[model samples]
Target: MNAPAASSHLLPAVAPRPVPQVLLDALSARFGPKQYSVAQAVREQHGRDESSFDVPPPVAVVFAESTEDVADAVRLAAAHAVPVIPFGSGSSLEGHLLAVQGGISLDVSRMNRLLRLDADDLTVTVQPGLTRKQLNEQIKDSGLFFPIDPGADASLGGMVATRASGTNAVRYGTMRENVLALEVVTASGETLRTGTRARKSSAGYDLTRLIVGSEGTLAVVTEVTLRLYPLPEAVSAAVCSFPSIEAAVRTTIQTIQMGVPIARCELIDVNTVRMVNRHSNLTLPESPMLLMEFHGSPTGVAEQAGTVQEIAADHGGKGFEWATTPEERTRLWTARHNAYFAAVQSRPGCRAVATDTCVPISRLADCLLDSVQEADASGIPYFLVGHVGDGNFHFGYLIDPNSAEERATAEALSDALVARALALEGTCTGEHGIGLHKMGFLVDEAGAGGVEMMRTLKRALDPLNILNPGKIFVL
Candidate 1:
């Protein structure tokens, strides 16, 4: 496979230049030698993300230890007109951390601290560096859990920055719904706090939302206040195999329409099942499958499972197996979360060109069927998995990263899928924000007028355009 022709759709090719000596001296003095680095290895590590876009690394990396450190780093970068990009777990799949225009990468993974935990209010405040799994482990004794599990143990700040959601999003909602307030460091390095611990507010401009999905294009997030939920009293997992993809999708549609209240309803095509079987050492039917979980009181969970089982049987679902123990449930979901790795490892030296398109439940069957057909026809090795309960799914195209033809074929398939999703009044991206990969799709999703309004807001907030330049849009 060969790479596609260069276009404005990607970050414009920019030559890397050395960081100014004066700015380097100042940053080194402020952060100390332990925190600041101009080493090639450090720069290279900070420049890339989990996405497929190839970009040059930043000139320097700063491992910030506190909110004051972030403020100072941004302030110094602003004074020198250097681009500053925030770094978290680097698990983002949209090239959000790519240093398209060379400058510095400010790492916040060291600011891991749990500031406050209010079990009474069902809320917690913490530094941005804490990962989701760590947060849950800390609060598990209280019988409370944070539900935004993106499957990567990703940083809370990174999750907030991407406005991410995962398996539980169908029941618990995304970061936009869970995050109540934020402490941010602006373009000029001034501290700004948006919202509060209050559940809801009519306060002013709703800056928290504006910054939530900005992808570091507007400001750097330092702390996040999150909403938590009590652990469910009853939980159970089940997997059902279907005769065909449509039958599986129909089961999901009908389940949602019937109001089953399933906590997690995932769809895995036959090809994906094969990969998981190989990667996770599972022996089950090699057919289209739906992995589901029910949460509530014992009777309620039983009732929900009964309702879904009936719907699945109507669609020719069989081999219903329930994971009634904690260990069993964890093993099932861990395999599901490892689907991406399984798909990639299925083909040696292959990278995943993944697509996430969400449609209304009414149109899911059409959109997903067409996409699966297109991917199959492309003759590219691929896998399909979806959070079908919320009408969102992914198609992972496995291709040789250095082969332009393979890249082009994968991208063409992704473009066709996005077009189909848009035609059906769906979104181009469900969770991943508009980073370097999908900037072109933004204008199509949000009309020219709408995009212009976004640019205007960007300018109003960061007049210097020194904050994560060459992202979202090329202002």
Candidate 2:
């Protein structure tokens, strides 16, 4: 069967750039037969991500074990002007890993290592391939932990590339704030360092911020130095169910406005609560729910919870359950993190077209309620979840991949939702970067002139246009 037509937000079909045999031979010689793979399985694995797009896989996969390995592989790809798509844990949702202009998939999962740790400064430097869970596990005993959790146990490199934020972002901020430094492999195969371990700098260019959310278009991040946080003395997790999403959202807005330092405030609508209940084996109240966490001294946490409980009470929130034990807290959060998978499993053989939009705290209710009404009217099976404390949320519209009609309907819903977000002075994407899925929305969010400015930077850094080509606005 012919593939479904590209959505208005997706890149049109493009021929994959030819990968010359010499480049493959060179890579094989350098990395050996085991490390360099032309096998279909490896290429297929590296070629796609959680996105709905079905673009062809890259020509080959090159496993890089070190920064030297990444630099060498990139240099070889540069020599032939071949697109080099960096592969992390393969959890990105925006088709970021697709090889639209086929070349090589540079797998950095083997480069996983903790390079440096400075508990005194609350900073640590790690290789790009190290996952967030692994990093936290390694540093758990140090009294310091990295708090940027983007749903997936994503690689630090991938998290840095996408400027990801998650449940903890309501207080700790996203990668843009936490990522202090980077060692990047430039398009020309040269290694370059940006930022420093210092908390703040008045240095030139601020290349660290530039590369943090560049989506691998500017360069491949080899190492990331991140700001860490000390584990809180007392931590508490709680869930409160509301009669409606509006009630839950209003409570959240009030909490944030009243200056409550909520570590995580996530919203799971009734449908998603049911899915999570089934998937995670929990008997959560099947209603619009807020999963929240508080971090501080025991008294401080109690005070914060009491204030929020009163606010929730005003909004008709009830069944405020607390999971104070570590195991219970883990189970609740694990279910929250597994929401996407739970949703996916709820509908077998379906592809999800997820929408990520964030509005101002005051405008969230307006933006979200209208979108919810439209989604309910559309008759698509979906799950609603959000880091609502910061005005960001996602709706995963599950559709049968084989049905062109379903794909078009899902795209229409996403497009209208994005237009609504932009109209409310919000971004089309809060965390998921502009990969193949949101090219048009990028132009809508950042005007043509702004996009051109991005293209200018892309050209200057990657003149050959070989680094993750056809992403973050066509260059």
Candidate 3:
């Protein structure tokens, strides 16, 4: 399956703005040749991300090592009215990193450094370029870890931009809840700080959160202060096989309603389980399964697991497998994290049109089952997985990009799924932001008046429309 061409109508009709030679020369002189690059390889690398959209690469890449460097680059770009797309780890699944309107990619990977760590206060401030895994490793010695893990080893800036949530979201919440403060570079190249280390405040605008999920359309994030958690004293993981996806989902709904406080509760349908088994070399039961984790005191962990096991049994869940050792737990999660890759590999030369819809926990089963039926009937190969505890799930519709019919079918399936989610009072995207794919859906979800308000805010902050132009919405 070859990658399909993205619909031109879905993208804004904005031509790539040319990068003037004088602007390039100034950037090269300001940052030195080593940090400024126009090499085809560098620009191409910074252009696309995990998204399937095939847009042209940026004309140049600026490797900014400090907040001042970012300010300078933005200042130069502002002068030229060239779009500036902030680049982090480039792991965003949406078209967040695409240089739709050509300009310079402000690469901030060089700005990764731990600026401050308040171990006692359970807070840490770091450069935006730091990856979540790197943040955990650096703070592990202090017995604290960041909980927002969006599967990919995504940079903190990227995660914040997407307001990412993962398996742990049921317990720890998303970036919207974990983030404390932000140091952002405005469209005019001025530094603005929001939020504080204190737990909460009756601040004026809550600008920290405004930038948390703005998708780089509002401003560029340079520094982030995040809330951290102390490692649990007791931890255990388990996998339970179910007769059907409904059973697994019902078990999860019951567990959450009962207030189990499960650290992680994920659902992988039988098809996805097979893919994981083949990819990870583990013979998990080739059935709908729930992979769960519990964290607390030893007694509390045991109690929670017992309650969940009982709920699973009531729903015909059996073959409960336990992974207590750290090695065993890691193996289980690594396989779960690799589910997307496994599904993609299952269909050679295929691109996945992944769907992210989240509803209230009570409505999870309805939203998932109906979508599953539609997908199965469409005859498109897909994999189903969800953080069911929080009513968020993804369906990866694998399609041959060369087949226009297949692409349309997959997209139709996605459209139906989003409509269903909305009818059930859910969102079109659970974690992924409205980059290039879901612009219309954002309108559908947020309504015309709400989207207009967002546009108002965008015009107020970035009147020049030079920051990540042609994203979130059309000007």
Per-model lDDT = 0.89, 0.92, 0.90
Q: What is the per-residue lDDT of model 2 for residues 1-475, given as tens digits with 9 covering 90 to 100? A: 1222323555667789989999999999999987999998888998789999898899989999988999999999999999999999999999999999999999999989999999999999999999999999999999989998889999999999999998899999999999999999999999999999999999889999999999999999999999999999999999999999999999999999999999999999999989999998888889999999999999999999999999999999999989888998998886689899999999999989987989999999999998898889888899999999999999999999999888877888888888888889999899998888888878877889999999999999999999999988776
Q: lDDT for model 1, please.
A: 0.89
Choose the strongest candidate by TM-score. Answer: 2
Task: Report per-prediction Cα RMSD to one decimal.
Answer: 2.1, 2.5, 2.6
TM-scores of the models, in the order given: 0.97, 0.98, 0.97
Model 3 stretches astray by more than 4 angstroms = 1-9
lDDT of 1 by residue, 384-407 (tens): 989889999988899999998888
Which residue runs of candidate 1 sit more than 4 Å off their true CA positions? 1-9, 13-18
Per-residue CA lDDT of model 3 for 1-475, tens digit only, reads 2212322225677889988999999999999988999999999999988777789999999999999999999999999999999999998877889999999999999889999999999999999999999999999999999998888899999888989999999999999999999999999999999999999999698999899899999989999999999999999999999999998999999999998999999999988989988888888889999999999999999999999999999999999888888898998786689999999999999988877889999999899999999889889999998888899999889999899888888888887888788889999899987888888888878999999999999999999999998888888
1 against 3, candidate with superior lDDT? 3
How much is the lDDT of residue 32 in candidate 3?
A: 91
Please rank every candidate by TM-score, starting with the best.
Answer: 2, 3, 1
Instruction: Evaluate model 3: give its lDDT.
Output: 0.90
